[model samples]
Target: MGEFKPVDLFATRRDWDENPREAFRAYVGSIEFVQAGKRGKNGADTIRESSAAVYISMFERFMTWIETRNRSFTSVTQEEIKEFLDLRDENGKTRLTSKIRMVYVRLLERAYEHLNVDSNPAKNLAVGREEPFRRGKEKAKVILKVDDIQRLMESLPAAPAWNENSKNKRQRGWETRRNRALIAVLIGAGLKVSEAASLKLRSMKPKRVDGKIEIDLEIWDGTGTGMKHTAVIEQFAVPEIETWLRELGRMDLPSDLVFPGTIDTADELSKPTIYRLITKTLDLAGINTAHSGGRTLRNTYAAQQLASTNDIGKVGEKLGHRERRATEMYLDAAKKFAEDAV
Candidate 1:
């Protein structure tokens, strides 16, 4: 093995203050670690691309799995490890995907440094053997059109199942107002559904200064929630959004979630629930494709924002993009605009 470089895991604290975490993310992304020519290149190149949260989750699970054998990662034999990798099922016969196994490899690679192992066994095993699985490109890229957005907004209140008239008129009105506010903040703020769903009452602070109310949105950067990007983009909240904020404030439950979970917990809305809500809203409007939910609205928000901008840099900043290059993904073709105008 080449001379091993020590990893400064604790160095995150110092770096976190001096640089934006996104910059650190970009820096980490630029690094390419070396691994020997092995059975394939699959495992060697997989770790860095995995999201940090996913990598951590996989590590925890894999560590537990190895516990049964009473083996630390360094002491495990290559064949034993490979067998573990090849095993399709756990004790319950639950099949593991190849993507998951790669996470295991990544965890071991990091853990081995603490063990001071001279040679890495998993480094070359099945390298280049399999292609990484990814979320569908179609799902990731779907965006709603302006008419679809209008339809979605219009369909919010009267959408049958959730809006049956068994309750008092005021209760129904409150629910409709809350839903509208949720949708408006989501679209207006360009929040990920998770971020919007996990919001808290304390996060929205309003004060009267010079006879005018000034609102400052304080977002919780708690784990697995909103991105710093979304918060940056939606820096200034307008009057309509504030009206919803006012409604949210009246509940006066300090610990309650601003958007409320399924049972009123502060937990963010699950992706499945968010997907169902968006799909149902669109389906009610008679739109054919409703499978693409929060993501579609998010993309539409970006595209519309970009279409209205003459300044790429401003849009990039507002969108909380890593760089202007990332903002190009939402940019519409200029040639189409020219042709349409002519």
Candidate 2:
């Protein structure tokens, strides 16, 4: 599908899935969103050019985060919506004021409403709405509880049956190990989804330091941050990462990619594939959550680091955040969880 030109932006000629990129083009084209923006709080019937650009910019930035993390609009949950704002606030030059952040929640809610999504995660997130969480008291699903995190680590999904597919039994073995390692690295390294997708074999090399498994995973948070940092995985996920490395080498895959799509192709895992893996892991751990994705693990990792150091600055560094302000929310969360325990 081609970019919908001026006149064609308003019509829904085909299903949104036919061309999601194209559909977003229609969304940002200013016709549909203009209608949405006109009705929200403090909204004017006629939008200024600069004002319209604000909504477009919001969509563009949000979509960038979504695509970077290998997620889609339909798959985004309240957890992701909050995480995007937090990331932008952390990485952007200017701070996102509470008022502006509220606007973000409203805009997302409106667009999702217009697009006919199953549920609007952004709904009632902002404080002005007339729901239970409207005053912002809703418990966010940002990180797994400490108990749940323990459960998740203990309940790694089992490998597929070797005898079920006799000819490809070995393939199943590596694939299972591959899946387990992916989850371990995610929890241990707290990697962004794209970073995980783009990971290479050499990135985790020098995997052992002084004969102990200390994977020095390097990550560059792409999308204009232009920063590189290392996450040291010492003991949390050592065994799984070790097992996966062995299986990955034995597969004889042509690609250097640590997590390739298949044995034959060098393609990175798709968004849905990563999403499903996270979901299945959570399910196996018997953790009930509305949003089950990598970001929760990312949050868990941040919290774990914070617990270890009791230092927001150090946690921010471990999380590869250049600005300490970006980690303020995590600090707040860590404090709140501590208080709950008390």
Candidate 3:
């Protein structure tokens, strides 16, 4: 077979969900091929299809926003771009995230470059800075404390309740077991949500080191860059994982996916589904699920590890961060908490 190319990876045709200004639509369309096939200096395709789609979609939305204000691409100013960054719907919530803002800003910058405009208005506009205040109070980082994690764990049932009259009772039981195991890996191994979702059944193995048992979890970078690493699951989580595996064995499910969505499907659970699972678990634990999800668990794990070991390098390695500075935020937070306690 030829080199495998994912069917969903590229769009051969352009399909806009809404009609944009003719000029804006034409401009975006002119660069479609370049956007789809953009490569880095190493001649590797830098943009993924998903990112291409997002850029195109955001450009269209930006065009729509500008049209309402009677502005065209050439006539747009940096101030207008900043206003767009702050654009909110009728509910009074900002529509763009920092990531989305950066994408839109890049799109505008590229548009200016392509059009050979003398000056690029978006060049100096900063993205990703937090607003001075959300109403009045400072925005807090979303994290789960040790007590919150304990409550979340306690909220999980030991096993799904069996009802002879209920259809697919065994399947439900297996789902519960699998969910518990999934949360265990998220908390115990500090796996990212995408990493957890992409886990294969064979990715987990029990190993003993220095007379202590641990679960060896294989973590894929999830960026489609083909990078792989390993993280250790605490010994305390091993029993629940074993129970989940037993349940999977009983269901005769394939070993391809550790967290399959349905018995009929072999595909791994989508990231959104994994997110909802974490949120639902937090809700059940009586914790505020707002501004928190699976990442909160990862942060909690990082914070706990740093608090215990005070080793930044080890914590960074465990979290799969390429740089020590990425892990420093957690260490700083841990220190701040300590100082506050004192």
Candidate 4:
């Protein structure tokens, strides 16, 4: 292990007053102790990536909560901690279990050790009681509602007209097509961001069904199952996919990746690139309730499918989830949306 260099996390808080996300990532990643954690059967049996995701995700949600309400993290107290974790929707039986809330409090304690903040608000915090009749523990999904989805779709840049043949216009046209397709595949098909990036020309099978186009995604490792599954891109996003396919065909690139990568001639698009793309897209659509980049979009797909079908097994299969519990994570959001419509 390399020597852990301790920097004052908020020694210059103002540096990130205008860029909270970047600062949060920087401080979190810089802490080496937090990353190593413990492993094996003796030491909590936790994997680094999975463990990191838990704490990092919890902290990110806290930051987003602050940002969304136009509040700063300058003087966050125990009261703020309580308010954030105590969040509950209308029926009060949300999927956020006691374990999840406990992790939020714990991560804040570990994080504040490096922060320049006054005191550790989460040092002895409690997440309060879990609502009655809670199911098994899982991360609470930041699922977008119908209006949010509509706004996102409408916000996607339209295909540029053919008459604008200038160099800049042509460049913009290709980017617009690529970005639009990326968003459509994520929200429309519910593919993981990495899975969508790994897509090749062969993965996509477009069919004209009764005068409407639908895309079939032949995924081999979509859910880490090794088995293959064919997920479809819903009709609402067909036009954007079509436009991207045409533009990609024109490039005649050496790589067959559906999206542009670090180098089009070879490597597939990087995960970070896809993450940033989705983050920017979400910001443009005015969505700040979640942290992960394309997760909200993928969750939207799950919620919508659950709402429309009301079949847990079918939605799980479509998402390439091997277990029913994995798909059930979207149930609270799905059920809420369904009930709201009535």
What's the TM-score of every candidate structure?
A: 0.56, 0.55, 0.62, 0.55
Candidate 2: Cα lDDT at 120: 76
Residue-wise C-alpha lDDT for candidate 4, range 155-192, written one tens digit per residue: 77566643334434235467666877888788888888
Give RMSD (Å) of candidate 3 vs. truth: 7.9
Q: Which pairs of residues have clashing backbones in candidate 2?
A: none
Cα lDDT computed for each candidate against the true fold: 0.51, 0.66, 0.63, 0.67
Q: Which regions of candidate 4 deviate over 4 angstroms?
A: 1-137, 157-159, 162-172, 208-226, 262-264
Please write out the lDDT profile of model 2 over residues 1-342, one tens digit for every residue: 123245245334243434555565556554455556644335633444444556667667778778888877777888887777665444464345344566678777876776676777888465433343334433453777778867888888787533432344246456666778888888887777767888888777555654334334444322223236666664767777876776666667879888888877888887568878999989989998767888788877787777667888766666677677666657766765565445
Distance from true position, residue 50, model 3, in Å? 12
If both were scored by TM-score, which would come out higher, candidate 2 or candidate 3?
3
Weakest lDDT window of 10 consecutive positions for candidate 3? 8-17
Cα lDDT for residue 309, candidate 1: 62
**Model 4, residue 238: C-alpha shift (Å):** 0.7
Decide which is better by lDDT, 1 or 3. Answer: 3
**lDDT tens readout by residue for model 1, 4-63:** 233353234244234323323332332232232121245553232334445445555555
Better of 3 and 4 by TM-score: 3
- Report the C-alpha displacement of residue 298, candidate 4, in angstroms: 1.0
Report the lDDT tens digits of candidate 3 across residue range 1-342: 123233322222221123233333454344332453334434553344454455566777787788899866677888888998898879697876554565566667766655556777876664333243222223333567667767877876467543434445255566777788888778777788878787776776655663222433444232222224567776666666666765665566654777788787677888777778788888888998456678788877787778778999877776777666667768655764445434
Give the Å shift of residue 202 in candidate 3.
4.2
